[model samples]
Structure formats: structure tokens, C-alpha cells
Target: MAKGERPKDSRRLSRKKTKQKIFFDEVCRMTKLVPKNKLTTYGAIARAMGVDNYSRHVGFALGKVKASDGVPWWRVINSSGRISFRPKDRVGEGTRAKPFTSLQSIKLAGEGHTFTEAGAIVGWTKKLHDFNR
Candidate 1:
């Protein structure tokens, strides 16, 4: 955090790890809603756990869980609340990018989350209080 020190990447990496650890338990609790109800998004988990700016960090934690831990990692999505698949491109074609949005979407869908036509959640955080409340 020094002057003219472009340590943004390092700072982000460290914060990502720390946020992942802090939000891990909350993410697990949210994922437990799956197989009975629908999937919960990373944003939901982060908000529930009081993490204002580390929503995607929750996704990283879930990915780590999928790789090694046994946490229920298939219950997260984007802010839009949709489960969109990664755009597929045939051989010798362009657009082979695999955005994490699709992965988050697929995992949430696997847990039975219902999406609207525009991909928003059916009934997301309706009862939650607003900032002024």
C-alpha cells in the first residue's frame, strides 16, 4: 500500500484468501439449503455473512471446496441470479472463453434454483431488510 507501488494483484490475492476463509462457514450453511430448496448465490451467502464486497470471494472458496474439501459447493450464482452455461465454440472457431458466471450458474441449477426469464431468482431476499431499515 505504498505510494506508486502497483501491488493491486498481490493485495487482491491476499484479500481473496482471507475473505475465503472468513466466509467459508457461511457459504457452507447457505449451501445446505440445496437438495431441498433451490441453490443460493455467492452474493447471498456473502451478504448473509456481512461481507459487503467479497461476494465473488465466496465463489473462490466454493471452488476450493469442490477441489479438496467436502462442502456442498454447488449452490452459488452471479448477482443476476441466473444459471447460464459457458458459451461453447466449435473447433477452429472463436469465443472459447469459459467465464465463471456459467460455472456458477450450472452449479446452482444442479441444486434446483428456479430462474426467471431474465435469469433473476424467483424469490430472492424479499423479506430482507434494506439499508435504511
Candidate 2:
């Protein structure tokens, strides 16, 4: 308990928050790389960030960004090519019973993409944008 010393738990929490902020920033940077008519998955971004299991973390970070940030958050989706929405944990907005906001869908469509009734992107495999390439 020196004047400049932090508690062990406090130190760890500080480091964790720093790492989370760095990860969130990286996620936004990568999301910006996706072009129109293309898409990337959560796991794909996690992999690019050098973490194999950060898919949820990727989604969580994007959920925190406001649309005015112009980071193209809608360009990222699930690994299976389906749009995630509602359930709060899914797309960062809406409830489990409420339909997801059309903002994402509308933005995506304006970029020349289509979705099935089930919210799965049509011909998604071809639209997959690979960062490694």
C-alpha cells in the first residue's frame, strides 16, 4: 500500500480494461476494411486480431459503436452468413421478441446485398471478404 502502488485486483482490472479497449479499437479498424458488397465474420476478425476465440468480443465491441462513427459495423456478421439481431447480445440492439432494426439491413442492401427470409445473406460465401488475402 505505498502511495503510488495499486491493489493487486485493481492492477489486474486496469490491465484488463486496457486490453479490452485495444481489442475494441482493432475490431473497428478491421471492420472499416470491408468494402461494399462484401462481408466479414466475427471469428474472422478475431483471427485477424491474433485471437482465435474472440468472435463474441468482436461483436460486443462493434455493438458499442454509434452509426455516426461511420465504421460500417453492418459489414460484419455471423460466421454462418446470417444476420444477428435482437437478443441484445446478438446485434447490440433490440430484445429477443422484438424484430431487429432495419438500419443494418437497409445499409447492407444499399451496398447491393440481399438476405433470405431467415436473415441469412444470399450467396454469402461469395461475398465473404477475406482479410488474409
lDDT per residue (tens digit) for residues 1-133 in model 2 = 8899878799789999999888888999999999888999999999988999989989889889876878988888898897776344344356769864666777788998888977888998898888987
Off by over 4 Å in 1: 1-20, 33-35, 84-133
Quote the lDDT for 120 in model 2: 88
Best by lDDT: 2
lDDT agreement with native, every candidate: 0.56, 0.84
Please state the error at residue 49 of candidate 1 in Å: 0.3
List TM-scores for all candidates, in order: 0.46, 0.80
TM-score for predicted model 1 compared with the true structure: 0.46
Model 2 bad stretches (over 4 Å): 1-8, 86-101
User: Across residues 28-70, which tens digit of lDDT does each residue of candidate 1 receive?
Assistant: 7666554434455666677767776777777766665643455
Candidate 2 overall lDDT versus native: 0.84
